[model samples]
Target: MENTMVFEEPMTAEKCSGHLSSVEDAIYVIGGKWKLKIIIALHENGNIRFNELQRIVAGISARVLSNELKDLELNGFVKRVVHAEQMPVVVEYISTDYSRTLKPVIMALSEWGRKHKKNIREDLF
Candidate 1:
């Protein structure tokens, strides 16, 4: 069994509409200035505290980070864990299984961005 998304051939208006809707839904969940960045940071760093995540994401204000985290959690891409067992309670954010589904998409986007940057630099020079 292959673990991948496969679209059937034969282009039709209905199929295109369905595809567009799927894309839009994905964007709705992850489309924001800081969502993907926050996801990438959590993905790379494992569980992290709010302040640490803010530092890792860089340039995102505390309020924005908090809001983004809440959004991500609401969308099922992130998990918030509150640790009240220890002397000092701690809160951490971790990427959920659903967030892992975006890995390929993110990598493809990153590749495209790199190529786009190279093209821009070449054009400028």
Candidate 2:
């Protein structure tokens, strides 16, 4: 015999509302044209300078990237470090441990995106 888990109680209004609030919070943090892209680049490259990150996250304007970095830093998903000892001060961005929690979410989204694009292409043909 196979064992399976079943929900003993259906989700109540309170539970649904709580779930929605949590999801909305997540969306507010990570929802944007370039947030995930920036995160992924940082994860791949480790700590990187502003101009290097701008180059890696191709197509994003300086203003938008600057804004996005500030938002990510504020949200605790990224760390901005500065080195002032040198004649030329250097600044870099690093992905926080909190941001690593999104790895599974990013993987799932990547898979879903590939499937979605394939489906759309099939439909178009």
Error of 1 at 110 (Å): 0.5
**Candidate 2 lDDT score at position 3:** 60
**List of clashing residue pairs for candidate 2:** none
Q: What is the TM-score of each candidate against the true structure?
A: 0.88, 0.88
Single out the weakest 10-residue window by summed lDDT for candidate 1: 1-10
The per-model lDDT (C-alpha) reads 0.93, 0.94
- Clashing residue pairs, candidate 1? none
Decoy 1 TM-score against native: 0.88
Q: Which ranges of candidate 2 are over 4 A from the true structure?
A: 1-9
RMSD of each: 5.2, 4.2
Residue 19 in model 2: lDDT:
82
- In candidate 1, position 30 carries an lDDT of 91
